[model samples]
Target chain A: DAGVTQSPTHLIKTRGQQVTLRCSPKSGHDTVSWYQQALGQGPQFIFQYYEEEERQRGNFPDRFSGHQFPNYSSELNVNALLLGDSALYLCASSFRQGAVSSYNSPLHFGNGTRLTVT
Target chain B: QQQVKQSPQSLIVQKGGISIINCAYENTAFDYFPWYQQFPGKGPALLIAIRPDVSEKKEGRFTISFNKSAKQFSLHIMDSQPGDSATYFCAAPYFNKFYFGSGTKLNVKP
Candidate 1:
């Protein structure tokens, strides 16, 4: 089966600009989450979307937002980009509701978009 | 605050040796611990994972040693090869969100 897919494998933006990255969840998955992995650091949760609604969010600012399409695809948009925003943005997907019950159920990941904000 | 903390930002091991990566989590609420492996131009893939109920779990040449009381876990790769060189990440999930460790980059030299 095809795994999660992300758009624009790489992107470059200037300070104070805005950018958007896209993600398509894995087949059979209904939940999508976005994470930002800065250089030398692990990915930090940005937000999660399920059933076309924002279900959960992390410590990110309002500048970071996301959307889930009817097909379970997702988009992550960031405004007023800063140098610190330059990082690898990853998308992960999982089945909803009961999927979380299985402790060993791992979230399938996309190759990720390497966002570089200058 | 990051719930999961991984040790050794980078590691170098001889080919045919064993490689170990460690991680410690503070949240007892975390029930799932997973290890992810990433290549230079690839996304992190699930290499192995373990649950709090299990002390150890092995699959093929990969193994996960979990210490629930210490809230710590580790990944061990037996017969490490140059192909095993990559970044390893430890992660925990709670409150519908996933938190990842700093990541460990392993280099297995022949």
Candidate 2:
């Protein structure tokens, strides 16, 4: 089965410009999460979407937001981007049953979209 | 603040040698610990995981040793190979969220 897929493998934008990144979760998965990975650093959780609604969010600023569709695809929007916003945006998917409070399954991740803010 | 702390930012090992990476967390509520491996131009992939109830879990050459009391966990790779060279990250999943360590770059020399 095809795994999680992210579009626009690489992107470049200027400061204060807005950027949108897209993600399609793996087939048979309903939960999608977004993360930011800086150079030589680990991935930081941005937020998570389940059942087309945002369920949990990280400590990131309000400039970062996301949406999940009925089809399980997701879009991450960054407004008033700063130079520090430059990083690799990764999309991950997992299968959750019922209204579980915790995730026991491992996440399947996509290659990610590399964003560069000039 | 980084929820999960990892040590030895990078490592170099000869082929067929053992490689180990360690991580520690302050939160005691975290129960699920997983390790992910990432290659250049790719995202991290699940390597192995362990729960607090288990002291150690082994999967092939990869093993995860978890210390619930110490809030520490480690990943051990046996007989390392060049193909295993990649960046490894330790993650703790708590309350439906994940906290990842800085990452460990492993370079296995042939």
Candidate 3:
């Protein structure tokens, strides 16, 4: 079973530019959630996608958007980025139903895309 | 607002000692609590977890002690090893969304 995978292990973008990060959820998983981890900080929830639709979102602004493809893959897009947007973007996949009770089940994380917005 | 708060920005311990990190949550509705461990240049991985209904859950050297009334929980590593060093985060899932603590950096010296 392949774990979550992210593309563009490292990314560089200029201010006012747009960047897109990709993720492939674990096999047999339906829910994909995105998080942003800044330097010396914990991962912050960005948003979640379920059934090819966005299910919930965090405190991020409109500039941060995401899409869940029919195949359960996801893309996180940031428009008009700022320097503060520089962080490690992570993609986590989990089974939406009966997830918490499964002892062997936990959020499968990707290596992440280290986004550097200058 | 940050719903979950963790303590000890960083910790250093000798090998064979125990390392403990604590976290508290403000939301009572949170049912599932999980701990994630992250290393340099890597994403956070699930280390251990517990539910509010349960007071304690153990997995090998890792244990999660949860206090429902206090809304507090902690991760304990026994006989800590240098490989155990990493930043740990405590999180809770609420309303289909997940919230995480600030994080604690743990370093074990051999």
Clashes of each: 0, 0, 0
- The digit string of per-residue lDDT tens for model 2 on A21-90 reads 9999999888999999999999999999999898899999999999999999999999999999999999
> Whose TM-score is greatest here?
2
Worst-scoring 10-residue span by lDDT in model 3 chain A: A97-106
Q: What is the C-alpha RMSD of each candidate to the true structure, in Å?
A: 1.3, 1.1, 1.7
| Candidate with the larger DockQ of 1 and 3 | 1
Pick by DockQ: which candidate is best?
Answer: 2
TM-score of B-chain for each predicted structure, in order: 0.96, 0.98, 0.97
- Predicted candidate 3: interface RMSD? 2.5
**Consecutive 10-residue window with the lowest summed lDDT within model 1 chain B:** B91-100
Tell me the lDDT of candidate 1.
0.89
TM for every model, in the order presented, reads 0.96, 0.97, 0.95
Best by lDDT: 2
Q: TM-score of the candidate numbered 1?
A: 0.96
> What's the C-alpha lDDT at position A67 in model 3?
97
Model 2: residue B101 alpha-carbon error in angstroms? 0.2
Chain A TM-score of each model, in the order shown? 0.94, 0.95, 0.93
